[model samples]
Target chain A: MLGPGDDAAVLRAPDGRVVVTTDLLLEGRHFRRDWSSAYDIGRKAAAQNLADVAAMGADPTALVVGLGLPADLPAEWLDGLTDGFGDECALVGASVAGGDITRSEQIVLGVTALGDLGGRAPVTRSGARPGDVVAIAGRLGYAAAGLALLLAGRTGEAFQELTDAHRRPRPPYACGPGAAVLGATAMADVSDGLVQDLGHIAAAGGVRVEVDPDALEVPAELTAAAAELGEDPLRWVLTGGEDHALVASYPAGVRLPPEWRVIGRVTDGEGVQVTGRVEARGGWDHFRD
Target chain B: MLGPGDDAAVLRAPDGRVVVTTDLLLEGRHFRRDWSSAYDIGRKAAAQNLADVAAMGADPTALVVGLGLPADLPAEWLDGLTDGFGDECALVGASVAGGDITRSEQIVLGVTALGDLGGRAPVTRSGARPGDVVAIAGRLGYAAAGLALLLAGRTGEAFQELTDAHRRPRPPYACGPGAAVLGATAMADVSDGLVQDLGHIAAAGGVRVEVDPDALEVPAELTAAAAELGEDPLRWVLTGGEDHALVASYPAGVRLPPEWRVIGRVTDGEGVQVTGRVEARGGWDHFRD
Candidate 1:
């Protein structure tokens, strides 16, 4: 436990590079206060930021979180938020470094994550050359499924996992470093839906991405919930977002992490496709949604 | 010319390190729709975060801003906010790297600042040793003075300076890197007024800081405004926060930057003092008005 006090944290960029990312969460827009505790929001916030770090194929090292709350927001809520921040950081042995507090009508949290590449070249979204393999570590569409469950007025012990996923997403933080170590070609977190985010990588990497329908590992809980709502489980997996799962492209013949499953491949094309078909669909759009 | 399609941004950490900081701005608590335009609010939000980076002895390199606004928030207002963000980042050649947006009851901005140390160790608050000279860069009481003017409804052209300071503080971003290059021992942004922020450095460095009233640079404009408000101008300069000025310590005989002025000295003591007198006064506390 060396703590935060330096001019800047000294993270080990063993590959001589650090991966960085940031995300912001706002009350009402991102989550309903009735649905989650302040701790849940805090955990979700940190988890998303750390997931971005993971997407870069790096190990989470430190985080800086800034919070804005209305003057009347309860202090207990703040304490819960801090607890969540600290608790989630403890999961990865990282610490909150510094942040700023300001007044606002609602609560806003901004988190920045710093990560170490651990002697491996960063796995970037731009490196998914044609013929690369796409894989994901952690469950897909859980957050979106959870969001649907809440929207449908489902609760209690039966829907606990879905609710919990919505309130507090647990990203595969170590999987990022693992992918980097395993020489992942390109990587990103599934913040937006798998298809939408992959579109970004496809555009950036100048390669076409094709996801296979048969490869997706749809969790049984999500399948059951989808059935209850008369929704397609594959749609949840492909189109739902915010699972914060690490998705990466690996060179052919490279071994994937234990938890990761091969889902797609790269081609010398211009766009993203699923199951050999071009679908005019996306995960989440900030304004259009 | 290149954007964030890559696995990671190749930011220049000239000193082999980057100084990072973040701030979250919530609507109402930090700003009022009746008082500030979307442009002004956006600039102010970016200014506060940039000021934190400046305090770290680093050059502002990039900023990632996340916005949360209501569905009813006019598109033009969001445009104004984005323009303000772009304008401020342009001030120091920093670019907006990436960000997230969501729906909320009010506008929430989460900003992360990435800075280049330019080949110097970051000047932390704990490095101020005994006999170090304390210096300040940027305005002192202008923001407080502006706040006073706003509160009084005296919003004509006469109070433009004060109002402008309140809306968009001009932090000495370059001074952070300058201090690093000049071997500054300790540094912090004066967001909470000089006296209070000095107390932070003092506590961290285990050295008492003393300010000489005679050397204080209370802007004449503030003096005139304070007279109108029947308040003390020096009080605003000494205790008024949100100016985002950088205060640092240098070893004796070291030449200070032109933008920086010698204001006091560091000594072996328990706390911060002004003019050989101990004062219990400081800046705004979060829980209290």
Candidate 2:
């Protein structure tokens, strides 16, 4: 993989097509420096964009980062931020190919992830057919739960893991290409909550997605945190965003990878639905209150 | 030719390799609201990134824009910005492939341009050799002159072109691929003043670049503005940046393209030099005062 120091970096696209996705993270908007370390912000930025590539059923090969920061920002912070990008890319054998740096009032990171499909037909959101089984890989509400702990000033050892999840999500990198190999019909990453993201697939596929609430296995961390805070853990599971979980639709009777759990089903309709109830929409919208 | 609304965009990299470049522009730092319209800002953002691709001797195929804006920002502004992107891409027959939008305190844009080499060897900054003739393909001082007019509060029909140049630069898009076809030994775009940018090429190529100041054709606009502002016109030509002019070195005895003018030559040694004098470096540096 080519690196920075040139006008542009070159990346190999052996299959004659490249998958590209971008994400933007702003300081005080996406993350707070006082709460999350620079490393956390960088890793989160990288993970979110990389997950987009994975959702396309492609293996990420490179990332181009465009970073804007105040002039007075510390060099150490930048170093930590780049290290975070490097570590996250290393997780799935990708590299930071190139980037641009500029001065801004606050820290802003724009990451573009490039992926290779390795000749497999891309699994798109529009391909989910009626009767396809919906499955998900990776944690659902851990990041949201972690955010709640941070907001409540809960920094005890008991809440450390939850808080860390909020700071930096761990996306299931292998599940994207794995799902493709397993013949996934449609796929999307849960960056904007499970329901909202599923709605995207449903709308694109011209079908309906029904999630079985009972099938969702809530992690103990979320349950414990919800009990301590007197909040419903299921809300976080359904509406929580930033978990970067990969969810896919596979034809019925197809064997799924071990990490995926059956969560729902697709039908001939439109939008997403909870098994026996209509759920209110809850997800992050940049333009909405 | 694909557009946004997907997890990732699929671009055809027919040559099995893609060239990538990115640039980040902040509202206050890169452009002032009073000085530039949303359309101008968007077009400028696209131009700067696209110029980097052109500098690499590749044909730009697509761009991914990551925009961070305040939630209350006007919808018309966003629409205008996207139109500018579309207009700029149309100039080179490219497309805005995909992007992400998020909330931020100030408008921040991160643009990544992807280009196809089209079977040509990439002309890199490291390829210049001793005796190679240095040449330029676009305007040099218009943008810097425009900025000077804006700073001096000289806004009128007489200075409108300069002011507009400050707002939106017209990079020589065709010169990059043209230079490649003509066998340019090394190439770079003059985003950061002529001297500073050539210094990059010199450093990368491990050769000395000598500019013949007498040979630089100072445009009448720059000369008139310099006279009105009591500044040296040569300063704008030599040190003014943001022109997005393509400069390259070609081997001796090779026929130069009609649009490219011989400015100087590459020689043994290192760093950039003016034929008879040592000039102070002047260019945009994010970290420098």
Candidate 3:
């Protein structure tokens, strides 16, 4: 593993295959200085992209970050961000191998992550087959509920859990490759709303995915927060983005790991269907409302 | 190779290793919408990053781009930029494998390039041994001269070549891996000023790098522009940035490719010493003047 002294970093890919993903986080659009600490932004940025590599059923190896920092930004903030990147990368045994930083008007972070498949076949979104059992491994509506609390100016200690979830979504990192080992047909990271994200799998696989609303256990904290905000917690569970939960379809009758909970099923036809009383708002679209 | 529409791209790293580099280009700091077309900006961004990969003595494989665009930007501009990326990638048989785009007030471009070393040891900066031949394999000072012309509002038919150099630098992509095959001891992309960037190699290698001014051909156009601007052409050749030329050190008496011009030698001392009348501005430092 060649390190940072060179113009480019060299990483070994034992299987002769490499996986790459990239994301752009801009100030005001992705985060606000007033709302999130530089450390949290760093963790969130790294988490989102690492989760993407996980969604591809690969182990993240390194991250190449490109930063556009404001001229007057405090050195302390950048240090905090660097620490955040280190901590997040440590969670998955990855490193901040290389990056570029420059002066700009606002904080803009561009993170690219590389991963290794370890000779295993990639569990792509289009691999889902009919009769597969859809499952999720991690939190769903918590981030959405947390975001709602922040927007309503209700930052209370009692709701800190939800708020923290919004600030940093704890993605199920290992479940990605674990699911692959378990012969997962299709997998995706729930960065967008559950319904919308699953719709991608359905669209790619050309199979109808039906979610059983009863199987989704909305947390009591999310329920209470929703009540305080005069909003439906189930809606958050259905449409929240940034939760970074791993959603995958395993073969029918396959014994799933303890971390995974059955939530839906793959069937003939197309599109994703959530069967219940919740009205689905789809998911977050940056270009649209 | 896995293409777009997946969570992450899968690329074949034939030698079981991957080389990666990243760069950030801001709208005002790196380029201006009024001065450079969107296509040129795209090519410039890709060129800068790809040049870094090439500097590592690797054959560029793919690029992942992250773009932050203004909502009001023209569709035509975006299309042109895409075309530019495609065309530039075509030069090295690379492709825009994947990327993420988000809305921002200004156009921010983040580009990450991946390359394959083809079983050759990476030609790093610290590998330059004393008694090596210092050489260069691309244009020098032309981009700097072009910038001077642009700032002076001297863009005319006669200086089209110079302006084009600044707008879109055509780095000798093949020469990078070619130099490695020729046993280059150390290599670096002259993104910063030549003397300043070579200083990096000197510092890394702990050997003195001596540049002979007589050997560096200051293009006639650069000399003509320097005369009009009352500036030293040799100064530009020594310290101008953004040319993205490949400067390298080879073993003494080794035959270099035809494109390479012998400029100097490596000695047992440290740092870069240009033997001539011009002063070295070192190189472009984003944090300093």
Scored by lDDT, the top model is 3
The iRMS of model 1 comes to 3.0
Instruction: Write the residue-wise lDDT of candidate 3 on A1-289 in tens digits.
Output: 8878678899988889999999999988888788889899999999999999999999999999999998899999999999989899999999999999898888999999999998889989998899999999999999889888999999899999999998888999999989899999999999888888888898899888888989998889988998899998878887888989999999999998789999999999877777755323333442121
Q: Per-prediction DockQ scores?
A: 0.40, 0.85, 0.88
lDDT tens readout by residue for model 3, B1-289: 8878888999999989999999999888999888899999999999998999999999999999999988999999999898888889999999999998898898989999999999999999888999999999999999999999999999998888988889999998998999999999999999888888888898899888888989999889998999988998987888888889999999999987689999999999876777755333234442121
What ranking of all candidate models by DockQ puts the best one first? 3, 2, 1
Query: Model 1, residue B90: what's the lDDT?
Result: 90
What TM-score would chain A of each candidate receive against the reference chain A? 0.91, 0.95, 0.96
lDDT of 1 by residue, B175-271 (tens): 8878888889999888878888888898888888888988998778988998999998988888888888889999999987589899999999757
| Span of 10 residues, lowest total lDDT, candidate 2 chain A | A280-289
Off by over 4 Å in 1: A1-16, A70-77, A103-105, A181-183, A205-208, A267-273, A276-278, A281-289, B1-10, B32-40, B276-278, B281-289
User: If ranked by TM-score, best first, what sequence of candidates would result?
Assistant: 3, 2, 1
Model 3 stretches with alpha carbons more than 4 Å out:
A278-289, B278-289
Of 2 and 3, the candidate ahead on DockQ is 3
lDDT, residue B167, model 2: 92
TM-scores for chain B, in order?
0.93, 0.95, 0.96
Model 2 docking tier (incorrect/acceptable/medium/high):
high
